[model samples]
Target: MTTPTVAVGALGGTIASTSSSADGSEVVPTLTAELLVAAVPGLDEVAAVRAETLARLPSPSLDEPTILRTLQWAQAAVDEGATGVVVTQGTDTLEEAAYLLDLFWDRPEPLVVTGAMRSPAAAGADGPANLLTAVRCAAAEGSRERGVLVAFDDEVHQARWVAKTDSMSTSAFRSPVFGPIGRCVEAEVVYGVPADRIPPLKLLPGHAGGDPRVPLLATYLGDDGFIVDSIRADDVDGLVVAGFGAGHVSASMAEAIGRLARQVPVVFASRTGSGPTGRAMYGYPGSEIDLVARGAVGAGWLSPVKARLLLWALSLGGPVPRADVAAAFELRGRP
Candidate 1:
């Protein structure tokens, strides 16, 4: 019998954190990937684990560059004949990271991402359990072709639809549009929903080098359009507006957004956090339909964060026309 190899890429988050002092100790990302894998009791029984420390930072501190680096590491692991890969990081930005990975990772092997809410020093820390499940899922035959997954609290969430729903609970990640696609039960990976085979994003030749700047701004009540105007002064590549219910904004704000859209690609996503932005439902001045008429791209069901990442990637491809940007969103945002 041969054991499958699973590569573990460690990017420090709460799962790899520990208290630095006895009293008034502040936990930080201080553990290596090898240490995290070693802490799991039965990880060896699941697969031959190879560990690599990619970065050491709390997830909130992670930027687009770190994510691109992590994707490279995962591909390197797969090239080394590993059956799958596991990424351990902070839960704060796990959902966004996972979605980005899904967009770029075109391989068939499972790429599972997991994180911990409670630091290792805390009582009943869930890191070990989550790690164990992540490894098992990564190595499982069932995980292939499922796209990138966020495994936490025994649930397997598809990266495209998952969100960080809670702040401090072990069950922090959830896929609201479509519930988790699978689960890890007592070390066994179980598939509850059928796989939705969507093609990965077609990145340009030199995407990583472009470093396109896309800013995400959220709309609020009585926002006097100053912030929108303020962004005009800076050199920004694209913009994502997290607008109100069904992607509406104040009339003044809408006008400002329209002007910005003419300058750069402007994407509109719902601020309510769930559901897709309506394409042509409402016809009011500040409605999503109105915004689209003004040359803003509707984000469909994609959240603001995911929409920003997609827009950034599109911007990196160089001189992306509005139609190309809208088509990219349509390809990824559609069910």
Candidate 2:
């Protein structure tokens, strides 16, 4: 008969934005966690809630340091005996932020993230609905051990597979490979599919000082090797090439990638967003087979954003062996 404690942390986004004046003026993040939770009708019916405002900036303004700090805050909430935690931020980087948290959230309690596509002042604001559903999902016993979740538009998506597929509309987030694992209907959370658990990467708290900068390059038609050549002269520690189709670049890029692979770690991901990068599908110049033979690690099912984060994390632990880098993806990059 007792409700579990659910901690809700608010990082300012459209969910918290409001017009400064009654005459419909400039809108900004002006709502606090307490205000947000107060707007959610029947939220108290699900769980005992605790609210806190961690930041009041758009999600795009958030950097790695801010994200790392927020992660620490979430951990502290978990340590304080919160059964589950919900975070509200901008939808622009919700998928990426959730994925980053998944890599570090080594806990069984659900960490549900949600945000509104429309501002609170807009017609038919979704913030209240999303916040309420996020709390319900977080309080559910079935949501535990499912990794970080992005709950929006009544659907719950796993962090690793979810992406922002649309610019507008409430149905913006989607998992191209794996669909929603759960949905919130009439304040009840129903899980439709079982989610696989991925081992969290080993990243110590407050130890994100010197993560290596890894640049991602998306290949295009008639693309010369100028960018790669330019990056080769820079101080970047790693590169993730988002190749066309199933990972194919122009022949000129292949030659540059071949040369760069010898100097630094090169990860090949698909610019198409989702799908496995081909390993031996083609043997022609600039083919996936050719790139793999030239030591470009195929990023199997990992998006370019996630691939970049993984490579950066690996590089932060000092010079990792090439084989170890390949094994990291092989072991943890599944969709």
Candidate 3:
């Protein structure tokens, strides 16, 4: 059989970074996609690889337009007969980037996103191993139709559920609600639990119009909703609230949320690291039930960032109906 072709695109991160100072102190992304691919051992035996440097910015500097460009690149790669695709970027924003790609990646071939927690200058840097496993996962037959995946530490997680849970660990990325859906063992891919695949959002013509302003706010103790009240409905296209446990917030914030929901879409998600937002458990003034009654939608399992992305994507085609936004949350927010 012909070797499967995998296209690797580099969006510079720790995986492609090295020490920029003579003292070996500060590290910066300096390697190209071809250089990263060349460092991997036994990668040639797995698949025929095509490498390209899409961008050289740190993950934090990566914006929505860059991600959309990468998405288009991946689609074009698939059209060019590449069996799969691997995206290398900084781990800092890997989860968010992967999810953003997942939202519009309407393809059967796997698009795996991977990044290194440690820079190439660090002891035992993990870029090569992570990239190899990501390629293996991308080449795996089972990975098809699985949507965009975050491959890290030999584990494969669905983009919708994965998040960066730690700041300085090789195992920082995790699918908190459910563990990884698959793992690469001995250069072979093994899938454990099956993940539900949500249909990719359709991008209408001129979908790249203006950047939508959707801010994410987290509730805390004694929060008086001053920040929420300060945001004018005319300024923002949508809002996402990372509410207290099970999607509850201060009574004052809930009132402000209700008022804002009347003007624009408001999505509430759990602030806790794991678990879905409560739908109807509590009935208090600031409970999920109360928020729903006030027109805010519950982001069942989506994190605040992901919820914000969804709201932003929805509003890109102009003002989305509140019911339509709620329906989107109901579908994509579920596990």
- Highest lDDT: which candidate? 3
Residue pairs whose backbone atoms clash in candidate 3? none
Off by over 4 Å in 1: 203-205
Model 1 lDDT at residue 274: 88
lDDT score for residue 218 of model 2: 93
lDDT tens digits, residues 165-184, model 2?
Answer: 99988889898877888899
On lDDT, who's better, 2 or 3?
A: 3
- TM-score of every candidate: 0.97, 0.95, 0.98
Which digits, one per residue and each the tens of the lDDT, describe model 1 over residues 1-335? 78999999999999999886886268999999999988999889999999999988998898777887788889889998999999999998999999988988889999999999888878899999999999989999999998899899999989988999888878888887788889888678999877666887765566655678888889998976788888852488889999999888988988998898888899999988789999878898889888998889999889999999899877776667899999988988876
Clash pairs for candidate 1: none
* Superposition TM-score, candidate 1 onto the true structure: 0.97
Candidate lDDT (C-alpha), each: 0.88, 0.86, 0.92
Per-prediction CA RMSD (Å)? 1.4, 1.7, 1.1
